[model samples]
Target: MKQPTLPFWQVWNVSFGFLGVQLGFALQNANVSRVLSDLGADLHSLSLFWLAAPVMGLLVQPIVGAASDRTWNRLGRRKPFILGGAIAAALGMFLMPNASIFVAFLAPMIFGGMMLALMDGAFNVTMQPFRALVSDMVPNEQRTLGYSIQALLINIGAVIGSILPFVFTNVIGLDNTAPKGEVAQTVTWAFYVGGTALLGTVLWTCFRTKEYSPDDYNRYKNIAPKIVEKLSLTTKLANFWKLFINMPKTMRQLALVQFFSWFSLFIMWVYTGPAITQYIWGVEAKWFDAEFLHSVDVIPADIAAAKGAAGDWVGITFAAYSLFAAIFSVFIARIANRFGRKITYSLSLLAGGIGYISFMLFQNAEVVHVNLLLTEIDIPQGALNLLLPMVGVGIAWAAILAMPYAILSGSLPADKTGVYMGIFNFTIAAPQIVSGLVAGQILKYAFDNQAIYIIALAGVSMILGAIAVYFVQDNSDSTPDERAIQGH
Candidate 1:
């Protein structure tokens, strides 16, 4: 029997938790490097420090996915992992920015890195199950729409989380600068709010949506139920290895595309703040270090203020891209249906590549004014120009979040959805891990430690991803016409 078609609200409820998840992630992506820099990490070692996130994801997701596939309890199959991960992630968020307070025992950077690992591990545990849960619930025809809605919520959350630091600093009048070896109040408070948001939305999804029972799931997927058997730990490990070795063709083909895409993204996350600050605002990496600032003969207030402002602007730029992504998500299903997922995805990645390449062209820091109802706000012309490129990045991001999963869901066995989804995360994590390991060395040796050149390299990687998209075979049964109809 075919799975029942879920109503729009039910589909919305299923993915609502991602809003909070992305919120926490947005804060981490936009600000973690900046935080590490504040606590004394140099520009060259920033990506190495960021190795915590992808490393944790690489280790955690597959295990969580396989475990969740076999799990069923009073709270439901995926919900237990989701709720538990959210709680752990929330605690990590609360503590990570405050690592300086625990300096009596461990160095702040070491403690912060541990928290980063915990948060990312928890995020991977929570995220892998959500991907499977959508496949488990949504019917074949509606899968695109379901994932598109998930993308929308993810980008929406990202927008808010990305901007929180800027809002706290500019609107709420919080101190954006901190003493040596500490995080800014604006960033710390943003994490607190993000943690709360993460827990609240996850609870909503946990309470509002229900998972299918084993027998019902079997029926819906048109498969026979197998007898439950207790297996040895050795046997389980062997089974997991078999699954990895025998993953679907489509999954393997998509891995190359994911590698380039995520590699570029990892670079952007690690280098964007430093890149824009040095290239546009004339703020040097050394200015971000409190110890360096303290050791200077005369502390330049203007340089310090410029560094803080540049960091806040990085948050705003991240928010702009997320906003653009959210807007593009509204039409991703339709666009993919009209052009076919391959063409649509390729074109989107191409757009993002062009956007990243354009980063080097606009270096004007001339101030521009926007008149509010009661007052005026001034922003750098170059910063405002950066938003135009984000449009392309946003388009790519919308497709990246939705299309591959929509395509892959059709090829997966129903009972193995969780494990496969978890394994798929390897593609995402592996590239980031590689990028983290080498990006710093490339920046230091290849580009003379100028972060802007790394952004251009990311663009080249994205274009390669655009080209790689043509190799994947989409096995979904629904035609573009059917997808368009369902999307509407």
Candidate 2:
């Protein structure tokens, strides 16, 4: 019943779809707010508009997970769901940046919200299966390596997706500005390229890898199969609730860690655009007309330029973090080996917390020096300041994507991997729901509309998360090298 160690290339092939999946996610994270703002959503109302993503993830992921667990087909179980979700997500991404065109007759908010929901739902549908597949195929000892590979591919895709808008406008001569009530050409083209990457990479994984059949799974679990019948809708709902109420001890502990981790990220994703624009670029909502939400024209040329520049900087910050994530992912297993997963993950989160706190020093200053490879490059202080925090965020992100699953997958019942994994999504989606509901209100009232304060709050939340992670009981097994030395 032992699962054989897959060759390194095979392991990479199994998780490769994440690269494409993350391209869609990176595009959404880096650009969605800017698109909403371009369509004239007020800062106070922005979080409400962003609610569609978590709401959809909450509704979709568990259902897809439960269904996939019971599914079987010629094309294989997880592959079908992955392919379907990728297609739907790619379509949503393609339509997202073009939402302003619908404003001729329909409200831009309504169309844009629909596309966001569609993209989120599709992404969740694919994501759960990808996580479960790694659990399904990889043994406990290799879980960190398998998941970290996915994390590496994720950041690589993120770097490309995050930098696309910046590259389009600054390097390729795309107009970053549109007349009032329209998305910029740079963002529009970025979405186009992201959509293509989403579909293409997912297709690559689908064609190159094959999933274990249900019969093979039954053999692995030492169970005999009778004639299988599909569950009724009522039973699926009952099982979903039952699984929630009876989560394992490890899942319960990891839930606390995931709560703060995702909450801090939700805040960053929502406020980073406004924070940079208002704090760094000195652009305010008052400088432009909100009436442009309904009709075009009368936005000052200078204000539009400032907003465009701020959006590009946000893209650069995202790319910097993704770059760091890619660099750190390769070393995560080695670091985890020396420190153990708990201390390693906790330290990463602590570093990210300090990084977020560093935002407070980002005054509208002049030149900043960055030392890299024995050379010092001088750049604008705002740009240099933002890049420094990403180092910690990237390290924490690598752990976030790998460690919890590496722990929880070992404890889960093999027969119910899909359902339990689906339940894990609650830890991620619920926090975003909480943050989406309250983050904007906190920014407006608590800090007097100072968005930079939200990043500081995120830093505190991450530090608290590091503390929570320190107490979780790790059940991961030792690697083959260690086992052989022990004569196992």
Residue 3 displacement in candidate 2 (angstroms): 1.6
Query: Candidate 2 — what's its lDDT?
Result: 0.81
**lDDT tens digits by residue: candidate 2, 127-149:** 88988888777766677889889
Q: CA shift at 373, candidate 2, in angstroms? A: 14
lDDT tens digits, residues 1-488, model 1?
Answer: 77899999999999999999999999999999988887778788889889999988888999999889999888988999999999999999999999999999999988888898899899988999999889888898789999999999999999999989888887888888866678999999999999999999999999999898888888999987788889999998999999999999999999999999999999999999999988888776666444676686654777656768888888878888888999989998888777678888899999999999999987898989855233355767887788889989888898899988987888898889899999999999999999999999999889877899999999999999999998988756567674464442
Candidate 1 structure lDDT = 0.88
Off by over 4 Å in 2: 221-227, 285-297, 367-379, 478-488
> Which parts of model 1 have CA positions greater than 4 angstroms off?
288-299, 371-376, 480-488
Candidate 2, pairs of clashing residues: none
